[model samples]
Target: MNNEAIDIILAEDEPALGMIVKESLETRGFKVRLCNDGAKAYKAFEESQPHALVLDVMMPELDGFSLAKKIRLENEQIPIIFLTAKSQTEDVLEGFDVGGNDYLKKPFSMEELIVRIKNLLNRQEVQKTAAIYAIGDYSFNFPKQRLTYKDDEEVKLTHRESHLLYHLLQKKNKVLDRSFVLKKLWGNDDFFSGRSMDVFVTRLRKKLAKDDRIEIINVRGYGYKLMVP
Candidate 1:
């Protein structure tokens, strides 16, 4: 892994622990900014635009779960690791349910955490095909969550929107099962998440409306189809 390519936002309420971890990562050539609370971490995330996040599940003001959910609203693909004392099966599941890519138990070895970070970053990089896709008159950069319309400026899509669009495009002219998508994304095939998915679909529709040839058709009571000419 290229350590130079990484920038991290770490949030831990314990000041001593946070500093130690920050210094250790910095020693290994990672640019890490440590914050003691979730709200400060979020602000740093917005300002620094870090490549990954290491957040404590229990934090002052926002807490890691809430912060992670907030971040997911705008960016779904960024890597997040929850470093906390909570280590129950349910706790780990809860971390992932909020869009975290990984979870580490408290009292973890900094070395182990480093390895996990590298592995997660490498894994995500491997997923990128580095190919721009054509959807109607728009060009999509899936890795960047970007869509370019020939007649106007580029549209930046939220993480959920981008992933939903990807599935639709891959299954073009075919049905993408509603429950399947909900389970894969929100970790549950329930009514509330289904409604949330619908909201995302509507947002995508509006964004892609410029291209008349691109149609996201909902297969009533089933799923959605991305019809491309």
Candidate 2:
């Protein structure tokens, strides 16, 4: 999205189709590494660590599903789209079961393939910056401003408390600069704003006291660090 080329690994046995797909993806600014067999693709994946994979179900050295399972063992988050001529229900189910994120039947349009790749990447990015986070034994839902401990009733947090907690969690175990947080939440790092942040931090400490492993420590001359084991 920011002119950074997306890298893709494509494993296809058909020479002609493989070349066409490679050229099409490159034309749209994707850096593609085309492998003629599943074995070669696996090797390429090890070396390149591409963002996503497009694999043909039937290959020379290994099959796509097997390759996907192997890759899953190494990395679970990479998006995989299986390309195959077979459209059986079991085949589709097997694809999902074997860690394939999406399945595309053969004779598919390049445009459709591109869309799926983009969509999967987008979904993955969203997951990386999810609103829900786990803090020791507590679950913090940023959107709802609720913190729940085990099976206990959820504690409703104020707007400032929720925002402050989110930033602290974002930099968990590291000192979050006081000035940066002040400007982020209150638009200024004045004396009153800093005092307000301290109050909110105190309130948060009380709420999170249920979890003994969690701590919000003030770093003398620096800021606060949310410590979670």
Candidate 3:
């Protein structure tokens, strides 16, 4: 990954710390957008579609967890790092639960942050490289968000649908944990997210219904299995 081409949104309420972090990242060849509040950071995210995000947990208007949840609704792949003074186990778990890729405690080294960002971007690049999958008689091109059946019928998938299908394909023939999929795709395993996942599963089933060999089966208490025979 080229640091110069990477854009990062850094959301911190403290002006001094924000500038220090922004300047440090910029010095390392990253393009940094420094926003003082979570709301402004979100606006910057919507506008720039940055490569990654570094957010402070305590911010006005929208907290880091809330902002991350909102962003996950829009994009599941974008790397998000949360910075906070609170280092409790629950806080860290909450960060991940809200779709944060990494959690950094306050008084952290800039070098560590840079390394984490690069690592995430590299992983994302690898996923992009392996974007296509074959399921029974259907072909899924994740990057293009297109699913083709028998080389003729084509189904365009939304971002969520594409990700959901990708997860299912990864665990084909085996049960994919419902809670795991919900957390990965919807940022949380809440009631509404569960309902959303169910709806997407149905949509995917309908799209792949052309081929009877491909079936997304509910594992009852577990999750779903994409059985491709």
Candidate 4:
């Protein structure tokens, strides 16, 4: 077993180039799934659920932009890198709008590609460990989404509840931008989501009510504030 270091889906139609990239990454401890065409790449992606993507913009059956958009519809966090020959400003912007994390122009250095991938993975790890927070008498384990109270009670939180609490806690003593919270969690700040956010906030207030020192206040017309005294 080669330790499958970082799972990468490589979608390059050129057989020789694909082999070179795949061998290069594997030698460096990355587990790569090489698909010669876009359709096969998309299928492999769904089946293997790789950690990241290295997709060529021009491919048979489906282009990189379409594939990335499809994946983003299901997952917003997976890092996607577009390997393209087109370096037009509009092309780059379109890639970003379709949820690309980075773009590597054709004729790029393999070393640079490796570095970018590592940097993106590192950044994700950093974002994953936002910060453990202390609210009132509770210790929030953000990574595990667990809340421990009084050293004896560990409360597991639902995904929504946990993420909502994280955002609120991160802005302790200040207003949590309502729009930002909605966009980050729900992917939008539509009327329905805004209302739903209000409901979730109310639920959190009740959940943390055990500690009188902890309060989540609505800062009318702005956002909510988590106050820990």
Best model per TM-score: 3
Candidate maximizing lDDT: 3
Q: If both were scored by TM-score, which would come out higher, candidate 2 or candidate 3?
A: 3
User: Per-residue lDDT tens digits of candidate 1, residues 25-130?
Assistant: 9998999988999999999988878889999999999999999999988777788988988766556656765877766777888888898788667746844765
Off by over 4 Å in 2: 2-4, 132-229
| Residue 70 lDDT, candidate 4, scale 0-100 | 91
Q: Model 4, range 147-211, lDDT digits (tens) per residue?
A: 88877688765445777898888789899999998776654687756776787788788778789
Ranking by lDDT: 3, 2, 1, 4
| Runs of candidate 4 exceeding 4 Å displacement | 1-4, 131-229
Poorest stretch of ten by lDDT in candidate 1: 184-193
For candidate 2, lDDT tens digit of each residue in 1-229?
Answer: 5314689999999999999999999988899999999999999999987999999999989999999989988876788999999876567657765877677787989998998888768756754676788999999976566899985769976545776898899999999999998776554687755766787798899999999999999997789999998
Q: Clashing residue pairs in candidate 1, if any? A: none
Give the per-residue lDDT digits (tens) of candidate 3, residues 32-117.
99999999999999998799999999999999999999998898789898899996656765776577767778899999889878
Count of clashes in candidate 2: 0
Clashes of 3: 0
- Distance from true position, residue 228, model 1, in Å? 1.0
In terms of TM-score, how similar is model 1 to the real structure? 0.58
